[model samples]
Target: MLETLGRSLDSAIRKIRRLPQIDKDAINALIQDLQRALLSSDVKVELVFKMTENIKKEAMNTTLQKAKRKDFIIKLVHDELIKTLGGKKAPIRIKPGKKNIILLVGIQGSGKTTTIGKLSQFYKSKGYKVAAVTTDTYRPGAYEQLVQLTKQIGVKCYGNPKEKNAIKIGVQETKKAMNDGNELIIVDTAGRHKEEKELMKEMAVLEQKLKPNEVCLVIDGSIGQQAYNQAEVFAKTTSLGSIIVTKLDGTAKGGGALSACVAANIGIRFIGIGEKIDEFEEFEPTTFIGTILGIPDLEGLVQRVQEAEVMPDPETVKRMMRGKFTLEDLYQQLKSIKKVGKFKQILAMMGGGNIPDALKDDAEKNIEKWRVVLDSMTAEEKESPNLIKKSRKRRIAIGSGTDYAVINKMLDQFRQMKKMMKRFTQMRQKGKGGMPGMPGMGKGAEQFMKKMSKDFKF
Candidate 1:
């Protein structure tokens, strides 16, 4: 959803690369690009103006010499962008050893009940005894759905579907959950519009009855410009202390929902990236912003890629055991990682464990380029990479919009991995080796060390 925004921002950097100097004209042009991208993504116009003005003012105030000005100016723009998105993450507190009730309230269709399940799982994974209780009597089968979700996550669910009195259900179920020794009790309230007086009042009453530790307003990410109004009304109606934005899977309005958190002076406690229970994430601003700026969160990136469960097949495993790793296996692994996300969705959230700092950026940015390069290779070239002589490299480079040097680098990386595998086999034979469980760490790391060593000649 933020692809357009990232690409637009990248365009500004590319423009800097093309400019002879970071002069006043260049700063104005960059600000215009920034403003256009933010506004087009439905950012509040006033915020855009404010952000661009700040960027321009800072750019003009920089004392860097002409030779070093571009990098500083670009970094200034990136920093300002991060600041626009709250500058930092403040996670919602759900302490252990206490019956911490979290009341989730949101307008209809905000995915509130589902988020309750996700939130429960999140805390459960952190060793908290989690339970889910739903008082969503407004939406038919809402309680049933919540029950199923809780069942899937192995958490106990409370609240009767036929119970129309939300406050009664909330009070009873919340107490029951506490008595049952649940440390984190996520109470799912019925979704209601701010204008729905009866439902709003019921939510307020339920909040008072349950006395939740946190009253989180779950806003649908696609609510766009209306997030502020919804948040404001709910804040007025109840003790709205936290926000969770949901359905951020593909909606362009995601940016608006996120920015609205800042516009309304609220910090987003969590964000739902997909319908899956594990898709929910704590809103960490630095990692989020780093991903946007094409900086790979190596640990996060690796974990996510590994979560895709891409592994070598038996045949490939045998080859790997024999120290015969090949490009074919690497290509399949990379394709699976790509299935997790686009090669470069910088603003989309960003990566892997223990990747060298030097290679993380190159790795994050080159997946797409490598895909093109690999796709341009012939079947024979893939099966026998060493066969790609200078003439073949020249041909492939032209076809892939890359250069011969990059192809050589890739070849070197492949051989390096192969050699590392051979070394592992030799070490095991000599009873002198044990691989670390973590990818890209310890002695085995040499296999992945230079996988994306430096910028490719793309």
Candidate 2:
């Protein structure tokens, strides 16, 4: 989601690596590039300046004994950015008392209601007796939208359209939920524009009556720098504990929301990537930084992927690394990868760029087609792709409900990968000589790959 910013930062870091040393001048230049990148993304000028200052100071003062200069500089920048966003993660306060109320506030089209539903699902998944209540007496469809969403999530929702008293509805709903054995009451209020004073007053009254444990402001990542202005206005009316940035799945300027949190002095609690109930992710600083830096934090991604399937055998990975990767092994790898969501995200986590715009749709179709083709192949065929001739291809196409063209494409891709692996194996056997166009391919690359190969044999 922060693709632009990520790329810009990566480029800046690459330039830093060319410098002779991490001196004051080099650090200042790096900070200047970062400032330009943040400003180009429409971040607040003051915030950008402050961030650059922090990065420059940290990079100059931090002690680096054994690490590479570039690595130290990148870590400095990452740490400073985290500090600007919020030094320590702030979690939503859930009291031990009877009913812990959480009130959500935001402008229209800010995803306030949907965030409430997502939060309710998040709590419900955590084994909390959670219920949602709509006190949005102003908007016509507000109550219905929340009601339908809560029902879809199988959570209780309290709303009365005829009642104009939002405070009374919030109080009654909280009381009823407490008596009904609900420990958490999430109040979804009507969306009000930042300029609406009357609506703000009403929201304040509801907050006063409910005495919510947490007041979260939902923001749209696509709003860019405007997210900060919205948070400022909302924070003035009520104490906002955290922010929930939604609509991160598309081409939204998500970095702006990160900047907004810094400006508003609020911690981000959750990030909504899609409309699905499971799309909400708790804010994690290190993993987020790792992703933005184009470093595959395989440990983090593997945990999420593991939730969908049993862990792949370490022996299987070792076999593949040893150049014995077969179609059977490929099938198992695909099954593990598919659990982590889309192909694009998986590739990005592997330090690859986004799928080419023209190939994005085709890539998804190819994945679906490949799954069916693999399912149709026999055990012997899967163990050895070379055994698949034209007749086998035809059989697989007919069995999988796909065309011969799809089968041919899958075989072509597999052959290309096989050729690359064969070349790698040959190079590894050729005494540690550096191969042409091979990254880290000298003795260092070979040693690293060999170590990884051995380590994967769990």
The number of clashing residue pairs in model 2 is 0
Over 4 Å off in model 2, which ranges? 14-29, 57-67, 95-97, 193-195, 297-458
Model 1 bad stretches (over 4 Å):
18-20, 193-195, 297-458
Best by lDDT: 2
lDDT of 2 by residue, 158-273 (tens): 87888888888888877888889888999888776445998788778878988899888898887877888888888999988888888866533677777787677788888888
Worst 10 residues of 1 by lDDT: 343-352
Candidate topping TM-score: 1
Residue 350's C-alpha lDDT in candidate 2? 25
